[model samples]
Target chain A: MNIEWLSFLTVTLVTLIGSLSLVALYSFAVRLKAIAEDEVRGAGLAKSGAVVCFVLCGCLVLLGIYLIVPQLGGSGGH
Target chain B: MDLTLIVVLVIALALFFDFTNGFHDTANAMATPIATGAIKPKTAVALAAVLNLVGAFLSTEVATTISGGLINEGDNGFSIGPEIIFAGLMGAVVWNMLTWLLGLPSSSSHALFGGLIGAAIAGAGFSVVNYGTVISKVLLPALLAPLIAGLAAYLCTKLAYWVTKRPSGLSSPKRGGFRVGQVFSSSLVALAHGTNDAQKTMGVITLALVASGLQESGSHVHFWVIAACALAIALGTYVGGWRIIATMGTGLTEVKPAQGFSAEASTAAAILASSHLGFALSTTQVASGSVIGSGLGRKGASVQWRTAGKIATGWLFTLPAAAVVGALAATLTYFGNVGLVLVAVIGFGVVLLIWWLSRKDIIGPHNGVSDVDEAGGAISIPTKKQRRKMRKRQREAERAEAERMARELKKAQKNKKKEANGKTKVPTASGSKSRAQEASAPKREARGTKEKR
Candidate 1:
């Protein structure tokens, strides 16, 4: 059988990066929120940083949704 | 007219299969969130159902080729009729129901493909199947998808825990944040499931229409067909496959909010990425793999390998088992309408029987997880605390049983010594009254002597 090794590799790479980054970003956001709540110094900055991390995570989720729905210019041919 | 009736029956059966597909896979997206208490069971299923309804309207590109190039549908290939499709649907439905009852998260797509392949072969020899496509597309992906998703989830889980780790004295962040993240990630998985799976049924219905000459082969799916399929699936999702949900949520592994979030994110990412790359994988397998990976990633968490093994076994058997059932159903169709009616009767009867059996040990939203304990450790792997409790209970029971046996043994020994000394007599029916009086008289004499002393 002619297995598409290239495609397989691409999927593995993309899934790892995509999922790991998303989880990391969300974790970072949670950490920031905790820091903001626990400490007085730089609380405002930490809270804002948490917001940024959350926005990034949300964007990644949107990107995922974009890839799933074909009408939204996705190549999901399942 | 007869053909029309047959086509109608196939469409109806296809819709029912779609319903099963929805419920069988509800655990794929909702299990983690529910298990972690990120979402209530009823609310989680409701959200999944709604998302699935919306997702069914998202794409129709793949709906035109639901077979995924597994069947030989070219002009020179064997012509597959509506009857064959009917038989295939029956096989898929039966297999799906059986797996759900056993609470194994097998692939609905595999069941569908296996059913079609089996029916096609039974109808027109083995040449009608593309074994290469089966191997490359279905088999290979099945093996790889879980591994990739698991690795991603494992690493992601470690990262989540590391990032969230706190200083020596301060408390860790409330898992409420991770719970919120889980809600979104699980929702995405649900939406993706709806988009991918609902189309398969729509495609089957459209194929039946085209085969019966009611619609053009290249034309778009009918709106009514899409709508009916969407509703059927949504209803099924709302009903929820609580049994499978219990297995996935609590049986395979213990899921905390952090692990739940990581697992869901990995599942959503893997599914979206694979679909975007046109690499088809079973959503059920991906989710289960993620859960297992998260379990391994957590420092103290343990995966229930027995449960995982059961799920893997189900996956291996899904295709061949469904194919056998499909072949049997197709073989019956050779006798024409009488055969069709008979297949229907037998199919419905089996469905009813399964439903009846399920009721004997019902699993619903209220007691889904609680009931898992009795279904076998393969369906409900006890948590560490639960395992400890069970072991303690087992030890206590063993001690109690030992004490009882010791007491019984001592009593038996005492009775044997008495009989050897002739101090105890075996009573005969004729002398029973005299024996009882004699025994009492000795006891009275002993009491009198003790009083005099």
Candidate 2:
């Protein structure tokens, strides 16, 4: 394969890898949150774990943009 | 060796740096839940692992900071060769393991930075070091990031409660909207993990390029570097980071779901925002802030101020401490190939020794170390404070059960009397005598929960 093609392939692989991770993280967050009501006890801990996942989600969304679109400006006005 | 071969090898070593990073810093993301038992240990780690992997592909801002800003990379000036890259990665990786073995959450980003700085200084001279960038990009953020995140967490947590104050039942969810809110916030943290922590590896790979003369100085990060960094870090996250998870989950804060949510949300926002702006802040520090903030956010959370003090002191000393060690190792490498060989042997031996020593304590997810730590300290000479809390909680639960039983017994007697009068309405009174004898149901439940505790 051409060197350019190899590099493209690599980037594609990384994107897929990232996508899979996001799926896993989202599933964990949702499942963990669902279970908190019954199996998990603490009200405070369950809520926090959930939001922590949300933070992770937002970060992932941002990351998706960062990967798909390279030149987006910072959200915080620079 | 050929330059290309050396380059590949150095990149692999940088990946080794990343794997340790995932393991060492997993606690920063997942500790709050594991400590509070919002998620089981296995589930908590598994979640953190995947999120961290996804987070690595989020951005390359951190990479640019390291490759272009932190170090000077030019031929005949201050470039990091494959050899220096190898040595630097080794230094960073070693420090990560050392801290993990001790169960301290030091900055993996700082360790790598220090190693790279040490290697650059060794390869060329102090002139190649960009102190300004180090201060503004790395150090200043190190100082302020956690504080900002923590303070924000405190304020947001307070505000979250204030906003929710008028609601009827505490954490009652009344409608279950908060569950949806939680999913949103936790995902942000995981994504922030990808965007920020993963970028550090990208920087390392880019730095290796400059060092090995594979890329021109001041060049943008090549796609290969980005891919390699992403792949390595993602793989590392998949493997999981159990030791640091234990420490962070329990050691830093008494995390409840509300506080954990606030802290993690605060941390994710702080880290990703900073990363995008090209500030290479440590996620550990950001997470620490959120945890502390969560403590302040809750009306009365056990902040363990003493433990926070130790962690703060650790943060203060991590960069310089790792820098000193990195410099020492780099200096040793200069004593020719013999020095390199000796350092390698000695370093590996010492790292293995530390690992072995850590196993003696074996504070991990499987052992219910949280119960041991919260119940006491390090399996011996347990904290009197924890013991007191346990006793108090036990007493309260017992009291609550007694009240419940007394109420039940009174109602039962009333029903029994009414039945004799033939105006009975409490039809479930068929087992009144049995229930009176088995009023210990409440007590048994209390005991069961206590057993779990």
Retained native contacts per candidate, as fractions?
Answer: 0.73, 0.00
Q: How does model 2 score by TM-score?
A: 0.66
DockQ (CA atoms), all models = 0.42, 0.04
Worst 10 residues of 1 chain B by lDDT: B370-379
Alpha-carbon error at B371 in model 2, in Å? 17
Evaluate candidate 2 and give its CAPRI docking class based on DockQ. Answer: incorrect
Name the regions of candidate 1 deviating beyond 4 angstroms. Answer: A75-78, B61-65, B74-78, B102-105, B215-222, B241-253, B277-280, B300-305, B364-453
TM-score of chain A of each: 0.87, 0.66
Local error of candidate 1 at B67, Å? 4.0
Candidate with maximal DockQ: 1
Model 2 regions more than 4 Å off: A1-78, B1-5, B33-47, B73-80, B167-183, B241-253, B300-305, B359-361, B364-453
RMSD of every candidate to native, in Å, equals: 14.6, 16.0
Error of 2 at B310 (Å): 1.2
In terms of lDDT, which candidate is strongest?
A: 1
